[model samples]
Target: MTTDAETAVFEEHRPVLMGVAYRMLGRVADAEDVVQEAWLRWSAADRAGVREPPAYLVRITTRLAIDRLRQVKARGEAYVGPWLPEPYATDFGDTVPDTEERAVLADSVSLAVLVVLESLSPLERAVFVLREAFGYPYAEIATMLDRGEPAVRQLAGRARRHVDERRPRYDVDPAQRRDLTERFLAAAAEGDLAGLMDLLAPDVRLVGDSGGKAQAPLRILESADNVGRFLVAVGGKSVPDMSFRFLELNGGPAVLVLSGGMPDSVFQVDVSAGRISSVYVLRNPDKLRSLASA
Candidate 1:
């Protein structure tokens, strides 16, 4: 392929490469950096011997992400407060034709699952993303990671079990989730404690990620009463100029709170049995910068 053709090939496979990178490292900027590095490598590598561009590109992207993830772990940077994955816009558009596959992909990228994935070893995380999220067979995944099939399968099993045990199961209905989110936000904003309590499950949990840079509960809030009371009290004290809007984020509907036209925070709920089971709040200023552009 000529230079132009090679560039086109990389661009053609960019989406898949990006998807792999983002799944591997929950941060958007990190994912983009890894993908860019992959492109640099791809552009300079010997393409004459490359027969499968997609597989080769994915391998590069995944490996780059793994390296980056390890570096992040090694840095041991102390986050300001509860950390939340940067709210990502994950609209797959019309490219993903299968509903079931899309749901699986969405769940794999969810904040809950991503948090659990953080506990996993880098290699296990890679295997889980490739095998569970992308449905790559063990043999193919082994080739991508330069590991034996048995080893890949073992990683997959261990990762899957870890995630399953940690991630709170939730219903995956988009329509239902959207509706519940809308109602939950309305109740909170209006300081309707009764309404908010009604929407919350008895054992609903609230996880706030203000990273100590902002005002949020440093500890997780459990039970409908505690979560509901905290939200109502906080909602009552919100700035007079505060406002909110709904948008699809991280594969589901989310409420982006704004104060004087600036991003204040993000509120996303996980629903189970038609009630809000858990609420994820992203309030760290660093995490909200992308919202300005998003």
Candidate 2:
């Protein structure tokens, strides 16, 4: 039996645990599963000597996430078309008062960064999520992972280098991104190819994740002309009772397309040098399930 006080402690730390798990697994369902498992462990653990409940809970969550990640990697399941991380609904709200810290958290969970994180090893990903996103001290992270402090440092270094080299560097201004997203949405809705082209970089790439369950590009489409044309085509089609809503997803503005009041798709763009560098379209119904109520 879990005491109410113990339950309150678990609830207080749930957000951080969810953050760590989601970043590690790239799927909300998997992350929630890991968090639930962590809850079970936390409820049953012997806490007489546990001085830090937050750290203890985090350790259990991180370890569970790592094991789940390893299992997922070992399966090597072949996904249909390009796979993007499930769109995570984020609302930093008043919890993150510091602009700088808020930006860091948002950037870490961005679709662009999560895509890059998918390539890192399980341990490296764990280290990166804990150190970079949450700002955990190296010593603390080592204790959590049951690894030497020096080894944790090395993992963090390698993960940082790998992410820095591979992740797309996008402009981080929220206002700019939101403005462009609105403009982009307008252009697409009006079937304005030139308007769309004007906002896209010459080498802009569009990665659509439909899992072959919906209509999206089977392969990544590159070049402003190709991407612009595709958007125009998609925009021209009539979706019965279709509507759009702008929400902050993964720390930035995104367009959520709804058909008949149900989530149809999600669109987000990465901007660089004042032009749209990458456009992400997530149409997989499975991935959009959680966003239906948002």
Name the best candidate (by TM-score): 2
Which lDDT tens digits does candidate 2 get at residues 1-294? 789999999999999999999999999999999999999998888977789999999999999999999999999999999999999989999999999999999999999899999999999999999999999999999999999999999999999999999998889988888999999999999999999999999999999999999999999999999999999999999999999999989989999999999999999999999989999999999999999899
Global Cα lDDT for candidate 1: 0.90
Q: Enumerate residue pairs that collide in model 1.
A: 80-211, 81-211, 81-212
Clashes of each: 3, 0
Model 1 misplacement above 4 A? none
Q: Model 2: how large is the Cα RMSD against the reference?
A: 0.7
Estimate, for each residue in 117-141, the C-alpha lDDT of model 1 and write its tens digit: 8899999999999998889889989
